[model samples]
Target: MKKFLIIAVMALSLGAYAQVDPTFEKEGDKVKATYFHANGEKSQEGYFLNEKLEGEWKMFNEKGEKIAMGNYENGVRTGTWLFWEGDVKSEVSFDNNRIASVSKAGKKDPVVSNK
Candidate 1:
């Protein structure tokens, strides 16, 4: 039973991943790419230079809600990025595709308490 459950979960996850396969179209010097969710909603859209991610990018959840927005240069993430999680918002900064810093602002912050 455990093996069957594991296999079922794996298959479902893989199916979800496969559903968001990106599609690319050449636009001048850059290739614009757009990914779609399993429900046929836009997941993310951006531009690529020389086959590497470049310029601004926006990401959306399966429900078609914007979740993240950022910029990339030659496949390296740069500048500030904003992410939304429920009522919480996070700001992430990246340099050369590496996370530089992160800040969260919301009504609540999760913390484990031991009494």
Candidate 2:
């Protein structure tokens, strides 16, 4: 009986670590996917083409605050991406999925162009 009780407890505990599946919706040639946090808040959202990541994607914290925004093409990161943390904001540019340039600015600072 004790062994059965321990096994049951372990099985229930494993369920807590399980990942929630993302929801997908069809949109023309692309599919929009919205992934969720364990708490049911939106974690990230984006579009996929031919099962590969495509177009703009946005990520958010558990509280639903946008933390990062970027674009992907053919499953590869492309174009400019922005990240926000507290009062600071970072801009990153990509070329062929490689970092091309990066710049940062603060709430009280001037907007710096990517270098």
Candidate 3:
């Protein structure tokens, strides 16, 4: 019974991964890609250049709410990114795909851009 349960769990995991397929469309020199959750809601949308992540990317939660937005250059994260959680928002700056700094603000607080 333990082995059977393990197999069943593995099968379900594979099914979940399969459901998160991304759709791509050509956009001039870049390709716009949108990845969906298992429930068919958009999980993230962004652009690709030469099969690498490029340009702006926006991430959404399961409820289709925007959770994060950022930019990438040559598959590496660049510039500032915004992440929302409840009544708080975080601004993170990246340098060479590493977090350079981060600041949090309340809903009524003014957010300063690092970029």
Question: Which residue pairs in candidate 3 collide?
Answer: none
| Residue range 9-114, candidate 2, lDDT tens digits | 9998887766889999999999999999876789999999999999999999989999999999999999899999989999999999999999999888557867
Task: Name the lDDT value of residue 72 in candidate 2.
Answer: 98
Flag clash pairs in model 2: none
Evaluate model 2: give its TM-score.
Answer: 0.78
RMSD after CA superposition, every candidate = 8.0, 6.3, 7.1
Best-to-worst order by TM-score is: 2, 3, 1
Off by over 4 Å in 1: 1-21, 107-115
What TM-scores do the predictions have?
A: 0.72, 0.78, 0.77
Q: List the candidate numbers ranked by lDDT, top first.
A: 2, 3, 1
Model 3, 1-115: lDDT tens digits are 9999999999999887777678989989999999998888999999999888999999999899999999999999999999999889999999999999999998884578676
Specify the highest-TM-score model's number: 2
Candidate 2 structure lDDT: 0.94
What is the alpha-carbon lDDT of model 3 when measured against the actual structure? 0.93
lDDT of 1 by residue, 12-72 (tens): 9988777557799999999999999887899999999987889999999989999999999
